[model samples]
Target: DQQVKQNSPSLSVQEGRISILNCDYTNSMFDYFLWYKKYPAEGPTFLISISSIKDKNEDGRFTVFLNKSAKHLSLHIVPSQPGDSAVYFCAARLKAAGNKLTFGGGTRVLVKP
Candidate 1:
């Protein structure tokens, strides 16, 4: 059962533009949402995260928004740069699951300069 899904398999954006990534989950038990950025041959790195209690969280050029009712979340990258190009994965965690994470099919983002 794929509880989390990324409807779009890829996204392309020009440098200095905003890139929006979407994700949806079917599990209401999720208590946290996280986004990770992965480069070729590298492990996914934690990018940003949001708690179920909050609707939005921003850090520098990255921001994450969560909609509990819709079980949807999004990550926005402002002024995307060429170096920002990577595969982004959306993940959800159930507090009771204890470190277990459910990940969506990654969305590959390409920032064209």
Candidate 2:
């Protein structure tokens, strides 16, 4: 079974609106949670992340929330833009695992103008 999962295969939002993407995990040993954005034929770029010890982390319009009790997390994009349209992925790693990340099936975000 996959350790990380993104139940939503896709999400659509209008420009300037908020796009919320959800993720679930089975491993409690994870030390870090991360979100990445990628365009077609391009490598995924890190967007935002949160330590397992923290509940939330935000950078500009992107925010990541973690709930250890539920083994769940979510990524929120406020004021979504067309430039933000891409495939978003949720990934996690155990500090002891030495930077090996378990990635969830990505969620495709369509930010329509």
Candidate 3:
């Protein structure tokens, strides 16, 4: 069973719209959550993250929200662009879990212009 899960396999959005991706976790031990974007064969690039202590965190074009009690989190990309098309993964880790990150399957996003 996957500790972290991305229920949506894929998503599509217009170039200038917002893109939302969702994830859920089963472990109450997870203390940190992060979202990553990956291109073809390259490693996943870190996107936005939120600590369990915070409800939300935001970057320039990305935002992450966490609901500890519900064990859910979501990533929001504002004004999605064509270049943003990629496989987005949700990851979680326990501060005491030896730095290993548990990852969700991934959500493929397509931004159409």
Candidate 4:
């Protein structure tokens, strides 16, 4: 069963604007949330992550917020750039699963110049 879901298939944002990507999970056992960015033909690279214990985490232009009670999380990218155009995947890891991740269908983000 697909435990994680990204409702939006894509998002478009103007350069220098904020882009927000959302995800939801059916599994409450997941204890970690991560966002990965992928360029065409390239492997996804980690962008940012948040632990279950924290409500929010920020790093540079990327920030992740977790709402455990709602079983949802979001990634926000501020001042989006052209190079930020890519597909973003939302992933969740169960505490007892040990590195095994459940991923949602990616959301394609396009930052227009």
Candidate 5:
């Protein structure tokens, strides 16, 4: 099954705190992993990514860590801000699948100021 799952549909955090979002996948063939952030009524923008060959990737305030053996991944945002409130989607792609990505439903985060 190609289910890229984000178990929690929503999260809330106070500004300046750390926000963590989790994702899990069952497909062993997935090699490329990506995370996207979206605002209301807008398309998702790429956040960070990690390959099956690596365990962690970080970009500015955002960081992503992968545990290949466990089929788990997590995104961490440090010093979360009110503007950071949005929906985050985790995606994966199998090279054999032609780079087509399957996305998780999404997790909505609200950073309260």
Candidate 6:
């Protein structure tokens, strides 16, 4: 079973537009959520995170919202730019699990100028 899932394999958005990526988890024990952006062969970079105690977290152009009650979450990028083109992975970790993460397959985002 997919503990974490990003249903859409890819998404394309016009530069300066809004991009929304969705994610879902099946485990109720997951309490910490994170979104990582990866470019090509490099490792993923932490973009934003939201703890189970909170519903929303934002950083500049990126925002992450968590709905623990529904086992779902999403990442929103306002004014999406070419620099935002990459693979976004939604990850989760249980606080009692020592922070080891379970990552989704990933969703690739492309920004058209």
Of candidate 3, the 10-residue stretch with the lowest lDDT total is 93-102
Candidate 1 lDDT over residue span 15-110, tens digit each? 999999999999999999999999999999999999999999999999999999999999999989999999999999988978789999999999
Q: What TM-score does candidate 2 reach?
A: 0.97
How much lDDT does each candidate structure score? 0.97, 0.95, 0.95, 0.96, 0.95, 0.95
Weakest ten-residue segment in model 6 by summed lDDT: 92-101
lDDT of 1 at 79: 85
Quote model 5's TM-score: 0.97
- Against the true structure, what is each candidate's TM-score? 0.98, 0.97, 0.97, 0.97, 0.97, 0.97
lDDT of 2 by residue, 1-113 (tens): 99999999999999999999999999999999999998999999999999999999999999899999999999999989999899999999988878899999999999889
Candidate 2 minimal-lDDT segment of 10 residues = 92-101
lDDT of 5 by residue, 6-107 (tens): 999999999999999999999989999999999988889999999999999989999999999999999999989999999999999978977889999999
User: Who is ahead in TM-score, 1 or 6?
Assistant: 1
lDDT value for candidate 2? 0.95
Residue pairs with backbone atoms closer than 3 Å in model 4 (clashes): none
Q: Poorest 10 consecutive residues of model 5 by lDDT?
A: 92-101
- 28-49 per-residue lDDT for model 3 (tens digits): 9998999999999899999888
Q: What is the Å distance of residue 6 in model 5 from its true position?
A: 0.2
What are the per-residue Cα lDDT tens digits for candidate 6 across 1-113?
Answer: 88999999999999999999999999998989999999998989999999999999999999999998899999999989999999999999977877789999999999999
Q: In candidate 4, how many Å is residue 56 off?
A: 0.3
Error of 5 at 88 (Å): 0.3
